[model samples]
Target: MASTTIQRSAARTEVEGAARTERPRGAIAFGLTRIAIGWLFLWAFLDKAFALGFATGRAEDGSIDFFAKGQAWLNGGSPTEGVLRYATKGPLAGFFQSLAGAAWVDWVYMLSMLLIGGALVLGVATRLAAVGGAIWMALFYLATSIWPEYNPVVDEHIVYILVLVGLAQIGAGRYLGLQERWERSALVRRFPVLR
Candidate 1:
């Protein structure tokens, strides 16, 4: 009887260990997704800040420089102007356009891009980043009007918002991000919402 009890206890322990070690389906996929999205935001920040020529640079050869000659933000390139003047369309078009190139707008846009990208990439403060990203995407969605021409009534911005929300809900950062350590920090312990 004693041996049977010990064997049963050992078996249970093994089962629990296996369960603990088993990762959920798609955990890796979700982690990759998080990384990809994080890069998306980060890349935008890099491109806009340096005018790396993907969207905001000029080349001496009069060709679109995919790698050089950007109108750096520090050197006085208005990232908001192009979006406001060309991409914006809808009820807020005029309002957004008017605010384009404004000092406050530039600061807010640059800051949000950096913060959101950093948070997502590091897997820290992801919930806050998701919220901010969703808000930013929502504004873009509304500005673009979700038109069929641009998108079939659903676009990249909307997809990004959903993905950001999912990343926050699943704590994707915990799988491969700094979320595990972040959650253990005193600040997170006191304010669970940070998780």
Candidate 2:
């Protein structure tokens, strides 16, 4: 009877240990998704910062440089102009349009993009980044709300906002990011909001 009890206790401990270490289903997929979205933000930052011409460059050959000579933000190019001019269509269209080419607006937009992208890519301060990204996406969605041709009231912005929120709720950074170290840091402990 003593031997049986010991065996049962040991078996239960082993099972519990395994359960504690076991990853949730689809963890890898979720991590990959987070990385992919992070890359999207990072790529946008790179494209705009360097004007590597994905969509903002002009070639000396008098043709649009789809791959080079773009109007880089550092080179005094306004990233908000094109989108604000063409994509804006809601009741606040004029408001956003007026912000185009404004120096302060340009600086804020560029800085926000860089910070958000960097945080997401590095998996540092991801919850904060997600909140900022969601707010940014919400603004874009509101500015471009005229969209029956695309979908019935849902758009890329809304999808991105939802994804950001989901990532935050799931503590996605903890899975494969620097979140473990971040969470253990004194700053995080001192300011729990950073976690």
Candidate 3:
């Protein structure tokens, strides 16, 4: 009985000492928050990419393509001109109109959606993804601002972007993601700028 008590005391002391040597109390909590947000991004991408039925509808019914319909809904049935007309005024309207039907414009928009969505969800380049997501949301706001129902002036997108940015800036991935492994590699050490 005496030996068991001594062993218990020693174990308790070791645990206390180890706790004292750990990082800040908030690091683990913050890492968990990062994991949650990262999952949100990943889910968003998966939902849209697979047509798990979001803004575009089901993926299997040939309804995964939301870009064209989104642009149309923002505009006035002329997919390209609608959003621009809503956001641009006077002289800027002409400039925006010129690019409304540009093929590259749609391509850029689609690619941005894919990349930003992928990055945020994967927690790979979260900072870049968050920034890009913000820009995308901002443009969406611009396009839909004309009407309350069409735009609503507020949405979860803003919150998502901010959270993503915060997570990236804090290097949350280093604590709760593959980024932790990536950060320790010789390649990352050599390219310190990657962080």
TM-score each candidate. 0.80, 0.81, 0.50
Q: Which runs in model 3 stand beyond 4 Å of their true positions?
A: 1-53, 57-101, 146-157, 185-193
Global lDDT of each candidate: 0.79, 0.78, 0.55
| Candidate 2 lDDT (Cα, 0 to 1) | 0.78
Candidate 2 ranges with C-alpha deviation above 4 Å: 1-22, 58-70
User: What are the RMSDs of all candidates, in order?
Assistant: 4.0, 3.7, 8.4
lDDT of 2 by residue, 58-168 (tens): 566767554343377767677788888888886889988888788887777777888887777777788988888889889888777755347988888888999999988
Which regions in candidate 1 have their CA more than 4 angstroms from the true location? Answer: 1-22, 60-70, 150-152, 190-193
Cand. 3 TM to true fold: 0.50
Q: TM-score: which candidate is best? A: 2
Winner by lDDT: 1
**Residue 137 Cα positional deviation in candidate 2, in Å, after optimal superposition:** 1.0
Q: What is the lDDT of residue 144 in candidate 3?
A: 43
What are the per-residue Cα lDDT tens digits for candidate 1 across 83-176? 8778888777888788777878877888888888887889888888878888988988877665636656788888888998998887788667
